[model samples]
Target: MSNLDQARVASRSTETTRAALIKAATSVFAEYGYDGGSVRLITQRAMANQAAVNYHFGGKDGLYREVLIAATRAFEENAFLDPEELDALSPEDALRRYLHQFLLPLVKRDRVSRFLRIFAWESVQPSEVFSAFIANSPPRIFRLAERVVRRFLPHDASAEAVTFAMLWLAQQPMFFVRDAERLAQPPFSLKFDEDALERLVDTLAGLSLRGLSGV
Candidate 1:
């Protein structure tokens, strides 16, 4: 084969290999947690050689970072939100948009939901990498919630109150969907469908506004 043809083939192979590694790592990390997952396991899952993990991702840490980056990029692209645009929207419109933007991606994409579950589990344990990730990305939904609440509520809402309300609002979707096993049992018995999710969002937004207003 010509040198140019070989180069093209090599580039394509590298890209394909990297994509497979990331996919494998995401699943492993999500199922096993960061501490439990290993490079060897991820490579085996990817159907690539044991050395492939190091070759494609440098190591487990690199693979973890890539998994996060890929998930966040998918979220940023598919979730569809702009803080400035949100600021311009009416309170109800902003709340509706924010809820859909944050929840729809996770609900529609099983991989994203799995990643989120992994993130939540890792975050509770605490680590330098997790801390840095939180510090850097933060949660846009909190700011979005606060802004929308402020638009319809008293300007003097306490930061604590706003934060609590925002956090609660953010948790509603994940808790209901991700933890559905518990939610579906006994007294809760809450079965969530698309319509139910919409109602939950609307109710949470209204509650946030009320809480912020001290009503």
Candidate 2:
């Protein structure tokens, strides 16, 4: 092969290894979390050399960081609605629409469970990486959500109240996203097909409005 051909081959190989390492790391971290997940396990799953991670991502920490950044990116793309979309709606409509959009991430067919896994990791064993990742992520609709909620809350409403309400709203989707398998079976035996999801989202939105507005 000519020098140019050799370089092209090397580039392709590097891209392949990097992609594999990232994919493997996501599954490992989701399964074992950042602390328990090992470079060896990631590399084995990726079917790349162990040294490939060090070469591409610098180390386990770097690999884990990349994995989460990727997951968070996917989550944002699937979850957040544009704040501009709420501009034309009344506060009540905005709040209802916002809650519905927030839950949309949980309904993503492929990444919902993985995103839930990442959030669970954040809650259980947060690290500098998680903190930094959250800090740097672009403004989510949460800011708009806060504004919408504030319009209905009492004048004495504290930041804590708003945050608590948001977290409470989040739990509904989190349960469905994280516990779908169990939630699908047994005494609950709930379904989440199209009609069911719509009803659930509408119910959550209504409950959120009533609670926030003190209605």
Candidate 3:
């Protein structure tokens, strides 16, 4: 093999190793959380040596950051909202699109939702590490939803009204996922199938539209 060819192979191998490490770390973090997890566990899950974690990510903290970056990058790529396009859509369509973008991914990607639940739990009673993590990626969905609502709602709409609308729209998935036990009770059993998801999106959009129209 030529020297250049060998170098190319080496580079590809390194990339593969790094990707594996990130995937393993994301799962570990989702399962055990940031504070409860360790580099050793992540490396073991990846089937790579402990030295690989140190060499590739520098340490556990760095590995966690890479995991978050990878997840967010995938999220942005798959489901990003363009503020410019909001004006083109009718109020109902715009609101539906926004809610779908925010909620659909969480329902579909179970791992990401699990990781987010862990993150949310940590954020409530945060240590320094988790607090920094929350600061690094603050929730932008509420702000984005508020902006979209303002575009559709009357100028006289109060900030509190807009905020309430945003929260109401945002909580649809959380209500199901976070309250799984309650939802499983008699007459309240809710499954996250396609029909259920569509219903959720429609309900949130309808309610927000009514609120905007002062109904």
Quote model 3's TM-score: 0.65
Give the alpha carbon lDDT tens digit for every residue of 98-154 in model 3: 777655543566655654544443433355655575477754455566667776666
lDDT of each: 0.68, 0.69, 0.67
RMSD to truth, every model: 3.7, 3.6, 4.6
Question: What ranking of all candidate models by lDDT puts the best one first?
Answer: 2, 1, 3
Q: Lowest-lDDT window of 10 residues in candidate 2?
A: 138-147
Model 3 misplacement above 4 A: 1-11, 30-41, 110-143, 152-188, 207-215
Judged by whole-model lDDT over C-alpha atoms, candidate 1 comes out at 0.68
Report the error of model 3 at residue 195, Å: 0.7
For each candidate, what TM-score against the reference?
A: 0.71, 0.74, 0.65
Q: 106 in model 3: Cα distance from truth in Å?
A: 6.1
Better of 1 and 3 by lDDT: 1
Residue-by-residue lDDT tens digits, candidate 1, 58-84: 777777878878767765675557777
Clashes of 3: 0
**Native-to-model Cα distance after best TM-score fit, residue 175 in candidate 1, in Å:** 2.6
**How many angstroms is residue 105 displaced in model 1 relative to the true structure, after the best TM-score fit?**
5.1
